[model samples]
Target: MRQEITSYLSTIKNEMYQLTKFLYDNPEESFKEKKAQDYITKLLLDKGFTVLKNYMDIPTAFHAQIGEGHPKICFICEYDGDIKKGHIYGNNLSTSISITAAISLAKVVSKISGSVIVIGTPGELNGGSKITMCKQGAFEDIDAILISKPHIYNIENPKCPAILPLKIVFEDNLSGNLTSMDAYIMTINLLCQLAKGFKPGCTIENFSISDKVCVISLKAPSFDTAAEIRHQIEILTNTLGELIGLNHEVTLAELPCAEIKTCKTLNRLFAHNLKECGIIELETDKCVTSGSTLGCISNTIPCVNSYISILKDKSIPYPSSEFAKETLSEYAQEIGLKAAQALAFTGLDLMEKQNLIIEAKSELIVQSN
Candidate 1:
């Protein structure tokens, strides 16, 4: 069966590259990825599968189901390419790989015996696609999810910490206060002091000035700030939380940050899975990724986010035009196929066990200062 699926993919390899070139030639943003979605749909329908256009009620978003069985599983793919001029990271290539994988999974997983869903989501750059699907109950029945990102590294252990994104304003010109600047300065000092134990698990803690100091927007004066409080450990995450909560009792302008959560599961997987995946979108080669911001790893589902790693840059393993120009060897394609192979094997194993019904839960806590 594996050989059969591989044969089917080989037959379509030229078409896959053609889709890549077409999408690369015409880049589109989220919600507007018509050409990309159309091309992918065409491929799936051609393979004796049913394609659901706009499955999540989100335009350009879809879910393709193949085979049938007890546990319904889904793999994730995003096709919206980057249009920010020079920095194009293989949206077309990854999408092509993901769709190719999906087509193979469809051909292999017998619907009469097992079920599968290929989720082509848009707007990952805006950070809301999968979450939106979850809200619509798409995840409730899903046994597991698969996703991948461009990378120079591989999946390590728990990586890409959860983050809290906050929009805050400080003002002292109201009825009771010292001054916004003074409050800001004092809060900065206290937060920094508390941030020492807050470093690793709660690895990313940064602030930036946002809007102009206009209170009229308020008449007197006020400051706009945003916080990206990111952490990996729950305890370290709460350290800053404790400080923020303690200060909130004293003044309202101490400020809060963005969607922050210390993803312990994510962090642990970061250390465990680096041998599996890497986020080349951050830095190609030189495997030792740093910083766990929501900006880094949020929508990445359950266990896979744990697999991120840093790659050795002794070779330029990026998807840039420059890298594509160097076809002097054959390892990168092999590695990419390795990703597909792993996904297939994991998915097959999941399908094999889809009928087993069991329930269990546990909590493990670790502390670091």
Candidate 2:
């Protein structure tokens, strides 16, 4: 069955590349991905799957489900690329790989039982739609969620640290005499002091966005710690506002403290599939603390965010590099194909191997306990 799946995917490889090219050539911003959504929904619909638009009441989001019955699986696709330009981190490539894998599994659904869902999550550049969907129970019934991201190595199960996104503004103009530069300097000084215990090289630290306004974030081992830090910062901000003769307001967006609790069985399966494709998994490839919307989905369900290295310059990995001009580059195509083939193999395993699914569920239960 695995061989058959591989052979089938080989036949449609060109189609996948074409879709990747189309999305790369025409990029869209978050919540404004009508054309991208149209293409994705049409592909899934053409494959006889049921595609639901306005997912979670978000106009740009979508949920496409195929097959039926138990052991339902999901694929996460960030169809929204970089704002104004084409795919910078090769997100369009990731989307294409995910779409092709889901559709490939759909074609073989008769031989294997279970279901597949391709979730169109937008706003990856901002606070992503995945968080909203997870909060609203979008992944409530999914057994596993698969993600393909760019990296310099192949990671089995990555862990993301607890993070808080915060923004504070000084409103009262009683200090109407205060210039933007003055406000910035004053707020930055207060923020620097308030960022106690959050220093560079520490598990908990302040990652401030340098601008006229004081926008910052706190990362900690747990969400509670992050929240507490935010509270302290707010109190300090209020005190600073009073001293500076300005009123202030602070906004905080807190995420789950839970790590991307990985299912070992699924990770092992993915590693095996990747090795089959000449991709080596190393023990030194440790989980790094990075921020991604995948954090929300993994917190909600058994999900794995695997990174496939596609480094042409050796300096720019998938998360930070722009490939708009390299849409048809050989390096980009290679990465896209590897991502699609590996993910498709894993999807096939999830569908056909009941014992594997049982093992994955057991691992999740044990870890959760």
Query: 1-369, model 1: which lDDT tens digit per residue?
Result: 656666776676666557656766777886788887888888778877788988778889887888775555566777775675311445565565566667777777764366767878776544446656665666666555555544545643323333343333443355444555554555456555555654344432445444412110000000111122221222332443344332221212221212222334433332322234332332222222332222222232232332222133537655455443221113444444445545554455556544321110011112111
lDDT on C-alpha atoms for all candidate structures = 0.48, 0.72
Tell me the tens digit of each residue's lDDT in model 2 across 308-341: 6666665553454354555456776676676676
Task: Please give the distance, in angstroms, between residue 64's alpha carbon in candidate 1 and its true position after superposition.
Answer: 1.1
TM accuracy, model 1: 0.64
The candidate maximizing TM-score is 2
RMSD of each: 9.2, 3.2
TM-scores for all candidates: the values are 0.64, 0.86
Error of 2 at 359 (Å): 3.9
Clash pairs, model 2 backbone = 173-176
